[model samples]
Target: MSTDPRLFIDAPLSASAAIPLAREDAHYLINVMRRGEGDVVRVFNGRDGEWSAVIAHASRKGAGLTVADQTRPQQGVPDLWLMFAPVRRSKTELIVEKATELGAAVIAPVVTERTQSDRIKFERLQAITKEAAEQTERLDLPELRTSEKLAAVLDNWPDDRLLIFCDESGDEADAAWGGARGRGQPMAAALAGAGDRPAAILIGPEGGFSPAERDRLRSLQHVVPVTLGPRILRAETAAIAALTIWQSTCGDWR
Candidate 1:
């Protein structure tokens, strides 16, 4: 494991150059971590890849760091996207955090008729993603798109990206119809055999997807309706469950 501390900031960094870290970051490093000058850290931009750096100056307001060398090149992410109807604020944040940790290439919010929360705090969600990436040692942040209507999302579905729709309508008697088993083979096993095509998992709202929405999703060739389980799961639980299955099957869980 790399000993360098991971920090996410928006400032530009260049080799052997000093860049001022953000105030919040500086506090976290100095006041929080009690680190002083010359301590090593790792940084990454969604665009510039990852780099090794050392603290040059520390202050109460902020700190400055000098880039030492590039550590890892930007890595290619999985072709998986996570789309879900917005739920409550705290759970929504959890979903974003877990999705990032699970290696979702994109995090999209789809507004369905049953969606409980129409508004999302983008900044808060972004912060959750950043924190998750930092802790999980991920170099890239998932692309977060604004919420769109479910109908609109279906209308613009990419032809090649398979949509794994988590539905609740399957027969309880069938093992395949309930829980993670129906979601497909374990995420790791599925991804090992999967080609380069991108895929997405769609999670509905608290009240679940409307019957019409389910029918529409089933009708789409790109959408594959699958069940999470026989027992009803909360919106947030379903999102995490689906993501866990996908990551374990086809993403970084392996």
Candidate 2:
């Protein structure tokens, strides 16, 4: 990666195009980073490929840049989405950040029966994803959707898209986490048969999925219940682990 600062611009990018920076972006580049006139910076707009831009002017009011040339053509991650029930504030932010870094094309927060934190700071999460994409050199930011009920999300799920449910609980009625009986198939094992289908990974909240939620998910023909491992994982960890599995098995990691 180049030492120059990278930013996610919202303007069209092309050679010689003069793009004005947003207020916050101007503050960041000019005041915070101390970048001045003629300083080189990297930029992307999710539409255009990465570009090399030179700072046109830097002042207290704002800053602007002139596109020098395209550095890389536009590219995108595989068609993978991550649907996770929001947890605590910090953990939820962690989930979104890692999901972006792990190449999730979309990140959604789902409300499940056992979900504790149904509310979310949408703009804050968006900022998190944008910063993650910038630092990770992703050409586009992941589509961060608003929080929705898991049932509603499932009801409208596309038939062609595979939904991988990370089910940590088992069918054991007498043991912790419902025992180990009738647990979902291991993640890698289940994904081995999944091929390269467009897919999404669903992770439940800290309490895992309610029995009814689990049953409904298992009954869906398009939903594949897969275990992360014998041990239970936090919502954020499960999101990261599941994305890694999918990417390695059927996504760009190959």
Candidate 3:
């Protein structure tokens, strides 16, 4: 399996489609991977399913692969989104990678009162997600959205979609938020009967949501607040944990 490389192409994919590799991919395939003509590999675009392709042509500057047949048809996961406040650069990257692996349909950066940075390098994040999708054998890549204020996102919230809010201050015994999920409300219980309903998991920054922000989220009609556990988790850890819990209960993993 290691011999057969799986690559992600940004263009539409179909049988006999000539995929032109970028300079870096060309270098990796030819020099690093040490592949010759007639080698077979798998390729996919977010829009297209995975396909079997062969190296029809190779060169120093570039190599062209010919798409053969569809290995897996295009499939989408549960309409789950990850709305997180951006943290430090490396931790933010970790959140993106894990979210992709854990099956988030969309990844949007939300700016809360305690958000550390507003700048999001989509190019770098896109590359990381594509690499992660390829490595994790995911058919589709998670959509990345620009950073937006929490208030803006809430004001524009859709009526049909459910927002799973991870409030650090939530209590298992608290009457609010239906109590700690997976214990009182439980993550699975909060998501019960919500199959195919547009849902999102929101994680705040390291400093957590501000008092006003917490009140605002709690007051939202469509928001479902839940707790991770008794222990406090970092921003990145909470993001991954929330996605995993969602997938296991209501996403593709189920």
Candidate 4:
């Protein structure tokens, strides 16, 4: 792994712009990383892309950087969203981290009958996504939305966005939702039909969606029910698998 550190900042970055580091960031660079004046570090704001900046000084409990050159141009990833029912703390973190690394444009948490009542730690999740994006070379952080009821979300979903629902029990769903009748329709088949349309993936919690929730999802005109494979997967595993397949099929990986 590259030892050079990369950081996400809220300030604007332009050639010759001297960006002041926050106290926390200065501590990390000056103390944790043991960086000093003239050291090279990479930085990016979600909108500005990434740039190479040199440390201007190692001051009393703070530091500054002089923006040097653009390392990368601002670019957008495939317009893909990952909507999932929050799982246990660790698994939920796993989903967020993997989703960011895999290039999800948005991370939305949905509440279903099967989802636990406990609230997600939004602040921590944001930190996790930021760290994951930095580690994985993502130029932008995925947009994180607050948790919302699944019904309200479905009711107000944009008509142009296709929702690929990862139905764990696709074989057991009714025809209206494209269940067993759509048995041969794997996720790949769904994406093949999606073309360049804006898309989102919805994964249920560990116990899976309730019967009513499944029925409702199936009845949505824009929603496509898909199977990962013959084997059942943990919620986090399904999230990772679905993202990989989506990216390979029609995402930026193409």
RMSD of each: 3.9, 2.1, 3.1, 2.3
Mind giving the per-residue lDDT tens digits that candidate 4 earns over 40-151?
A: 9999888989999999977995689999998989887899999999988999999999999999999999999989744899999998998898888888899999999999
Scored against the true structure, residue 62 in model 4 reaches a CA lDDT of: 69
lDDT (Cα atoms) of all candidates against the true structure: 0.79, 0.88, 0.83, 0.87
Per-residue accuracy of model 2 over 1-254 as CA lDDT, tens digit each: 68899999988899999998999888888877888999999999998899999999877677899999999999999999999999999999999999999999999999999998888999999999989999999999999999999999988989999999887654441253354445668889998867778999998877878777877887799988788877767778889999999999999888
lDDT of 1 by residue, 147-250 (tens): 89989988888888888887753453134334433333333444455555689989888777775786677678876666665577777788788888776766
lDDT of 4 at 117: 47
Alpha carbon lDDT of residue 183, candidate 4?
43
Candidate 4 runs further than 4 Å off: 1-3, 170-184
- Note the residue pairs that clash in candidate 3: 181-186, 182-186, 182-187
Name the better of 1 and 4 by TM-score: 4
Candidate 4 local distance difference test against the native: 0.87
Highest-scoring model, lDDT: 2
Residue pairs whose backbone atoms clash in candidate 2: none
Clashes of 1: 9
List ranges where model 1 is wrong by over 4 Å. Answer: 169-194
lDDT of 2 at 74: 99
